[model samples]
Target chain A: MTIEGQGAVPGLTARIFAGHAGPIAVVVLAIVVIWYAGAVYMNAPRQMDVFKRANADWGAVDLIEGTWAQDRPILPAPHQILAELKKTIIDQKVTSKRSLVFHTWVTLSSTLLGFATGAVLGIVLAVGIVHVGTLEKSLMPWIISSQTIPILAIAPMVVVVLGAIGLKGLVPKALISTYLCFFPVTIGMVKGLRSPDPLQMDLMSTYSASPWQTFWKLRWPASLPFLFTSLKVAVAISLVGAIVGELPTGAQGGLGARLLAGSYYGQTIQIWSALFTAAALAAAMVVLVGVVERVVVRAMGGRP
Target chain B: MTPSPVQSGPAGSDGDSVVRAHGLTLSFQTADGPVHALSDIDLEIGRGEFVSLIGPSGCGKTTLLRAIADLEQPTGGNLSVNGVPAHEARLARGYGYVFQAPALYPWRTIERNVTLPLEIMGMAAGARREKARDYLELVNLSGFEKKFPWQLSGGMQQRASIARALCFDPDLLLMDEPFGALDEIVRDHLNEQLLQLWAKTQKTVVFVTHSIPEAVFLSTKIVVMSPRPGRIIDVIEADFPRERSLDIRETPEFLEVAHRVREGLRAGHSYDD
Candidate 1:
């Protein structure tokens, strides 16, 4: 019947390559150019001195106006930040205890531990709630209400209460991260588990498949995309929790401590730098989730 | 007919009588009330026989097929396939069933969808792949193995679903208006292919359809049913040659069989109303 002639043309490969390559290449080139420009401006010795002097003057007006002062101010310019980043990253071993790396490590550890704990608890809760109608109806409202109480207002009380019980350091910070991270995972997972259609469920039933088999095969695979999406949100919130935990307790190291120290002495540059580092770390964590998503979905025979 | 076992070939042979359901009565607890979906539905389909059940929309044709497939339990009556209870028959005999719509799993590729039953049966990987390819070829969907259900047309998806049903080489095939959703052209094409497949495999088929012409064109026996407590009104036997083609639809015997089916349908509808 010559029906084979009706098949689709094999041009999808070239089309996909052309569609993705151009935009990706342009974005990468733009980032590189911007980084090079910033590096050149920040590393120039004369520009660095002039910017340091202006920052020291605290003529915050001139600071915003991009003018230079004679003497070094407390806050450094973009040039100064670039020089500091280069010195810390390239020349000096800033990753050690004497540098910012020790603080970053402290913050990262708490965030990771809290994120893991929160994610596990949240998934277990979501599974329970989804399976049990009474728990879903009763607990969902309270979980939502818990989010309304601002973490900032509660952080001090948590620190004091835990301190009275002699629990300090990582525990309090991990608790805060867990509190912030769990809600999204629970909500996302509930929706995901319920995402499978009735017909699909019936198909499983028609096969005489047990409840566990149906869950593992259909519901779990369907929930994956949602799980990863919520994981990204949960990870970011965990980092926020760690930083917030540090704020009330006044931790000796970590980015939160750096932020508090910067605010105390009005070292706005140090605060900004720490804030940037936290943001970068959060972005990296989310990207890690995306990579895992690709691998897992592919393993499940799904296209990205 | 006192529900005799209609044997066409040797006992336990491929073309021997496979299913016999007598005095099947089905009632459903509908929102309106307890509705009798089917009653006094005595039928026997021989192995490799292509039989169609035709009636009005609410005439319980699908219900009858579902009863045979063990998907629906009859309120009062007996349904036995291969001398076993319908459920046991289904579990042991493993009949393939196709619904009104192509209930293809959206997440699976076409090949994967066809492989689903095999996966459930725990067939070895190499054997499953070979069977999947063979069934896909039978349904004329050889190259579309990797395509998702959403990527295919309605006709193609339905064909893929048919492939899925046929993959395990089931003894009896239960179809509930499987081609009722397709357009006339696609329907004609699928009907021809189905005839060829039936001829090749000699599988027992119990097809439910509303179209009188389709029932006449495809079946060796057409069981005309009445609605509102559906009962078998009449059974019209097709006297055409087994090697019938699409062009046979234009022939005199074909027209005669279709006319008798229509008359039976009209009689049933008038009696019901």
Candidate 2:
């Protein structure tokens, strides 16, 4: 049978363009233009200082070209950052400290470890808050207050305390990410676990299902969509947490270490490359979560 | 204030009543005050009877059904289901409840939704699937077993919910306006289908509805109720034949019963104070 709206290629193409691709292209172009402009603007003074040292005269065109190609720009151009990323991630050996991939692996390990701990902790807390009234009354305010304390301020203390006890390397960093990751999962899961309407609750009571049975059959699957959404947000912040945890410790490896070394020597291009790599890593983690969400929601008979 | 006369129950029913409530009263403790939902409700629903509790909005029809299902405890009453207290009966899996909305889990297929209670009861997977299939076929939803709740229409979703409720084959079914959301045509169709299913299964059903014609068409006994401090106004024996169709609604006896129900509702409003 011929379907009127189904398999309408031109309409589908138009919709995809209108909904996603066109807007993405416009925003990306705008960001690139602003970034290139910022690079030239920020690097112009440093380049001019060099020219002045040589007692040489220059114009805007020279400043623009020199700024884009500077060995150590104050703010690297987008193309320069991209080139550095390719060199560090693609050309350099995976085992080399200079390779961004190696640094990413070091950072990613802590992020994943912290994320897993945080996710489990958050779910357990959420379950506790949901099932136990006293926990809900006492814990929610404290959980919110904990987030208000800046991670940057807490990271050093955590590192030092752990270091004093001879706990070094990954644990401190993973703890920070774990700290960052658990809140959203807890809050989102609470909302999801309570999502079933009054009528649904009444139906469950009629079946005389135990609280455990109700959670598995009704609450958990219902909470999954919310959990995944929170996880996407949590995973992104987890990468940030790892990097911050690494920053205070001055670890000899990881992206955060690379950033610290760059800043110490005023190698702005190196700093920018590390920052961009971190952002890309975070995006990849979020996308990974999104893929898992689709697979799980579909497995549970949702439309994905 | 004049005393409201108490009606015992319908005659001509056999020995056992699935549900027996004596002066069942439920009140909610709201911020404003205690809101009396069901007051002095003495209802007896015998075995294999299709009883409909018809009332105005906020008249405790749903509350009464909920009490029967053991979802809510009556504030002051002696309520029993299957000769045991409501709570015990619930724990014994004595009844299946169909809510006002379909309440089907969006993440489960139609077949899976039907099998959920069975899974909860720790039935074997093979047995659960068999029972689900049988009930789905009974509800005329066999082809759509793999379809999710959202994929179906409102009527289809409600039917799937009914199948889920019946898959476990509970001796009693408590329905809270199961088709109140459906349009006229679908409601009529489901009403007819439910009657047929009732005849076939011999399960005692306590259905709550706002529609008089619906109550008349589906119920063996019609309970007319009124609002503020909700109480039953009249209990009328419908005495309609088990083997019948929607066309029976046009008959004189049906009209007489419906007329009595309307009068009971009008009489309820007379004592609104």
Each prediction's TM-score against the native?
A: 0.75, 0.94
Worst 10 residues of 1 chain B by lDDT: B1-10
TM-score of chain B of each: 0.92, 0.95
Report, to 2 decimal places, the DockQ of model 1.
Answer: 0.19
Candidate 1 CAPRI-style tier: incorrect
lDDT by residue for model 2 over A1-304, one digit each (tens)?
8787776557755776777787898899999999889988898888999889988889888889989999988778989888988999999999998999999999999999999999999999999999999999999999999999999999999999999999998999999999999999999999999888887777778778899989998889889999999999999999999999989988998999999999999888889899988988999999999999989988888763
| Interface RMSD, candidates in the order listed | 3.1, 1.2
Per-candidate DockQ values are 0.19, 0.68
Model 1 chain A: ten consecutive residues of lowest lDDT = A64-73
lDDT of 2 at B97: 89
Q: What is the Cα-based TM-score of model 2?
A: 0.94
Query: Which parts of model 2 are misplaced by more than 4 Å?
Result: A1-23, A57-60, B1-5, B9-13, B270-273
